[model samples]
Target: MSFKQLLYILLFFFTVSAKGSFILIPMDETTQQNHLKAYGITYWALDKQYKISWLLNYRGGSFLLPDAQEIRKECQIRGVSFEVLSDGESNSILDEISSPSQNMEAVVLERTPKIAVYTPKGKQPWDDAVTLVLTYAEIPFTPVYDEEVLSDGLLLYDWLHLHHEDFTGQYGKFFGAYKNAPWYIEQKKNAEALAAKLGYGKVSESKLA
Candidate 1:
């Protein structure tokens, strides 16, 4: 091939390779289409063994992930807004975030945290906002109640979300208004039964233990 042909070939390859090396998901209120789904995307990346950087205090704490077609497709499917940054551009952003004067840091995130929701089984607590959001985000979390907690099951998970929970065993002080509600009656019955099975005379005592 001629020298001109070789030059053109190299230029084409450089342009293609420099198009995008990083996926930047801005978490600011004005730009992000779906903030929660963006989190889902990060979780998805972590689950796939991708090491991502959380840009703390940068544009409201954005995420930096390696550019991949699969992740672009996921962001499109989940309605999460993102931007593609070339390698030089990505490095510049990181450098700005890493400066001593800037109040920002890029925290590396590699592990997918195992989440546990402390909620009573058969208590119909899944309808709550937190669980609903988690479901919508497609994030998997285990539901655990007093039974699991009493047995040291909490040690198995990395993060715990409280759902209609009361460690004091006072039923969240719902007695004044929900005392006549059938759900309230069932809740009291279940707590008492669980406490008895756990060898405690009162639910409060079981909870304290």
Candidate 2:
């Protein structure tokens, strides 16, 4: 073949390859090439005439809500950070997940104290438990104490937890506890005051139970 013809063929091939070429670019802005900065492309395919939208990590259905795992997956896909949500009773799953990450000082911001205790017969336990636990765990908690429920010996700490003790001063039980115990009367007044102070409205023993 003539030299000019060979040169023309090479040019033709290069042109075609450039037109159909595929380039993978890093997603970060700092690392992307200058020319590609204004031309970044994310290609999504249309499956059918009608687009079917499916949740990336969540279960898209009735009668069920996506769990923490699904939430985590969705957060990753959407470039979002996730914070553990709790309703104040149980959070064992969060504890397990955070355990592994606990070693990283950067990720460990603040530790919230969780107070769990058993109520014994007739009275409340030590208020110092909160201070002691917080001192050791390096966490902060607001202790709750009631004069009606806890005698002078008892002290309020971290956050107050109402045991089987009836705040209504009713008795150990509800409606039943209120029927005759003087402690029940003082308990009701004290619980009301504490609830008001804590921004929770007055709740009866039944409501608490």
Candidate 3:
């Protein structure tokens, strides 16, 4: 065979072998990885980029939920990892949380507030406060109502709090204040529906407050 043909064959072999080495293709849009690396955002890993990966208890990709959901889908598609990073709202004041070395293993906190307080029991705005605090403190937590908490029974978490919640049944204040907003309306309906499903008694002002 000619020297040129032999050289071409050798180059082809090397290219095939090198393909696996360059696995990750960084995206142009702002990603959680970019934020974590550039701005120090906390995050948990979803897939293995290498032999080792990390996981976090509470995961938020970006301050914007849509953006976060997009990143999650992208990571899953790439077979890279679905990492949950604190969106930097509540977790801002809290100490920086690290990723777990194991892929599935993670540190998480489940925030369970009584439904009556969040729903009909009392309208103290504690639920919103908890969410705001979690966002600001950059802490990751799963918000659960009484039924979910009782049924799921709290699995993983280093710490837990009641968030100064009320179970009297006042309903969250945001529902009234932000009724025009889609998210607010949806949240209110969902809460009411959930309460009914759990057989929390008839929804009423006197019972909630």
Instruction: Work out the TM-score per prediction.
Output: 0.88, 0.21, 0.31
How far is each candidate from the true structure, as Cα RMSD in Å?
A: 3.2, 21.0, 12.6
The digit string of per-residue lDDT tens for model 1 on 1-209 reads 99999999999998897569899999999999899999999999999999999999998899999999999999999999999999898999999998999999999999999999877776443556788888888888888877898889999999998866567878776788998899888889998998999999999998898
Using TM-score as the measure, name the better of candidate 1 and candidate 2. 1
Clashes (N, CA, C under 3 Å) per candidate: 0, 14, 31
Best candidate (score: TM-score): 1
Give the higher-lDDT candidate: 1 or 2: 1
- lDDT tens digits, residues 106-209, model 3? 23322222222122233334436755544443334555455546564455443456654435544445555777898666656766776677676544532353
Give the alpha carbon lDDT tens digit for every residue of 1-209 in model 2: 99999999999998654332111222233433331211111111111121212212121110111223433453345443223323321134324334654431112112222443334333432434544443343333343344223343233333445445444533345545464567767755665665565455545532343
> By descending lDDT, how would the candidates be arranged?
1, 3, 2
Candidate lDDT scores, in order, read 0.90, 0.35, 0.40
In model 2, which range of ten residues has the least summed lDDT?
Answer: 39-48
Off by over 4 Å in 2: 1-115, 118-122, 126-174, 204-209
Query: How high is the lDDT of residue 39 in model 2?
Result: 17
What RMSD does model 3 have? 12.6
**Residue pairs with clashing backbones, model 1:** none
Alpha-carbon lDDT of model 3: 0.40
